[model samples]
Target: MHIAQDDIMQESYPTVLQLYKLALLVPQSTAVVERGFSAMNDMCTDLRSLGQQTLDSLMRINLYQEELLEEDLELVVDLFKNKKERDMPL
Candidate 1:
């Protein structure tokens, strides 16, 4: 007895593939959200009053400028000094 071999290619299931794609698109962790809330709380404590824009700016700088956070105070002061210089020469 000889058995015939069926050569057939099967397409991936659409629903399974879509579900997988959706899973990848969704965030796996809430850590980022928690960190953001924590940062906001730290910036807006009872003793300190910060406007929404100011708080957002501070949070952005704190989150993005990890290296700047460690920089020397003199360096930061110098940056502000240079930034404050007038464009017109005396």
Candidate 2:
């Protein structure tokens, strides 16, 4: 008796392969989120009353700039200093 040799692949779970592929593609790290939270905690204190827009800008800078150069910071400061004054009527 001679057994015929045929190469055949059997997928026990069809969806498992797709799910596993997706799982591999997704980011497994929460470091960026954690860092943002940490930065917010550090930056915002009871004494500091930061507006929503200001806080958002600060968070963006903190999260993106790993090492900000002094010249870049000076430029930022100059821009803020020379920013158009909003005359809010009380």
Choose the strongest candidate by TM-score: 1
Model 2 whole-model lDDT (C-alpha atoms): 0.73
Clashes of 1: 0
Top lDDT model: 1
| lDDT tens per residue, model 1, 1-90 | 211121221134556555656777899899989999998898899999998899989999878776666776678778878896658877
lDDT of 2 by residue, 39-84 (tens): 9988889998788999999998887685665448888888878989
Alpha-carbon runs more than 4 Å astray in model 2? 1-14, 25-29, 66-90
Q: Model 2: how far is 60 from its true place, Å?
A: 0.6
- Model 1 — which ten-residue stretch has the worst lDDT? 1-10
Candidates' C-alpha lDDT: 0.74, 0.73
TM-score of each: 0.58, 0.51
